[model samples]
Target chain A: MKARVHISLKTGVHDPQGKAIRNALSGLGFAGLGEVRQGKLIELELDETDPDTAREAVDRMCRGLLANPVIETYHIDLEA
Target chain B: MKARVHISLKTGVHDPQGKAIRNALSGLGFAGLGEVRQGKLIELELDETDPDTAREAVDRMCRGLLANPVIETYHIDLEA
Candidate 1:
């Protein structure tokens, strides 16, 4: 199975990296841009065949190591 | 419109960050895991309303600034 975790900072939290990117884009002549937010995408390969089990494991993985629960949120996608 | 850019290292390029994540997962007792890869997701809020124009601008953004043509690949999704 394959699992993908999308981890992103909470909306209220400041994102300096995203701000830098937006500024860079503006400097490069890209106009009318609003907010630019950046996040992390983690792709995992798992041996489990069952979708439920795979999702559960990946959820655990996100909670344990992939994300900071207090300031970040994560979504998991599983494929078999 | 909204634009999302997903940037990832091309296959065959070394991924030390990914390897470190895989090792950490193993340390956390996540077994039966295969390759783990990491990527970047950038979300943009655009003011343009036309789909074609929005997409074109974002494509330019990816090619010119958001992605490294050398070893990184990027996919853009625009929403209105």
Candidate 2:
């Protein structure tokens, strides 16, 4: 099985890294870019598992390890 | 319009950050986790634009700013 999870800062949270990257993009000549926000992509390979069960496991993993819930939220896609 | 771009280190490239996160996951008791790779997700809100031209522009953005071609590759999803 494979999974891809994206974790991002919640709306209204300041993102200094994203701002820095956006500034760099415009400085490098990308026009009409309205706003930029950055997140993390986490790809994982897992042992054979039921999709629903695996998703539950992953949700727990995110809550316990992959994210700092106070500042971020996560979404995931799982494939077998 | 909106776009989400994910850029990752290619296979065989060393990723210390990924390793660190994987170790942390295991420490936090995520079991049966085989492997992990970390990447960046960049979200952009753009002015109304043709999808094809926007994709082209974004490809340039990745090549020039979002990724270091020496070690990364990127994919994008565009939505209006």
Candidate 3:
């Protein structure tokens, strides 16, 4: 099975990297762009065949190590 | 309008960051995980009201600055 996890900083958390990207975009003449928030996408190929089990394992992975629960939130997408 | 750009390394490109993350996951006891790939997700809030215009601008942003055409490919998603 394959799964993708999108991890993003929760709203209200300061994102310096995103701010830097926004500034860079403005400098490059993209003035119309508004707030930019950057996040991480982790694509995982799992050995497990069961979709339910795979989803649960990836969810655990996100909570255990992939994301910082306090400031980051993650969404999991299972491949059909 | 809102747009999202997902930038990922093309197959055959070396991904040191992804390797490091994979190693870290294994160290932390996530052994069932297979080949792991890491990518970037950039979320943008645009001043443009039209979805089509916002998508085009974001696509240009990806090609011109956000993603490397050689190793990275980007997909743009426009919110309704």
Candidate 4:
């Protein structure tokens, strides 16, 4: 099984890195760009066969070690 | 229009960040976890209305600024 976690900052959190990318894009002459946000994508291969179990464990990982809940939000996707 | 860029390292590239996450997960008692890889996701709000134009512009942005072609690969998704 495979799982993916997408971790991103909450709406109100400051994202300087994202802002930098937006600025860089404009500087490169790619026009008509609006708000740009950046996040993390984590791909995992799991030994667990059940999708539900894999998702549950990955969710726990997100809460404990993967994401900082105060300012970040995360969602898990499990693939069988 | 909205576009998302998923940027990830190529197979041969080493990802220490991912390894660290795997170690942390195991330390936190996450069992049956295998290889973990970390990547970047950039979300963009584009001013262009046409999907093709938006995709092309984002593709250029990926090649020029968002991703390092030597070690990373990127795919773009467009949403209306």
Supply DockQ values for each candidate. 0.89, 0.84, 0.83, 0.91
List, residue by residue over B5-70, the lDDT tens digit for candidate 4. 889999979999999999988888888888999999898999999988888888889989999999
Q: Across residues B1-80, which tens digit of lDDT does each residue of candidate 2 receive?
A: 89899999999999888888788988987878887999999998888489998888888999998988899989999998
> Model 2: runs farther than 4 Å from truth?
none
Which scores better on TM-score, 2 or 4?
4
Rank the models by lDDT, top first.
1, 4, 2, 3
State interface RMSD in Å for all models: 0.6, 1.1, 1.0, 0.6
Q: List, residue by residue over B13-53, the lDDT tens digit for candidate 1.
A: 89899999999999999999999999998989999999999
Judge the docking of candidate 2 as incorrect, acceptable, medium or high: high
For model 1, how does the per-residue alpha-carbon lDDT over A1-80 read when each residue is reduced to its tens digit? Answer: 99988888899889999999999999999989999999998889999999998998999998899999999999898887
lDDT of 1: 0.91
Clashing pairs in 1: none
Q: Whose DockQ is higher: candidate 1's or candidate 2's?
A: 1
The CAPRI-style docking tier of model 1 reads high
lDDT of 3 by residue, B37-71 (tens): 99999999899998888888888789888999999
Question: Which candidate, 1 or 4, would have the higher DockQ against the true structure?
Answer: 4
**What does the lDDT read for residue B55 in candidate 2?**
88
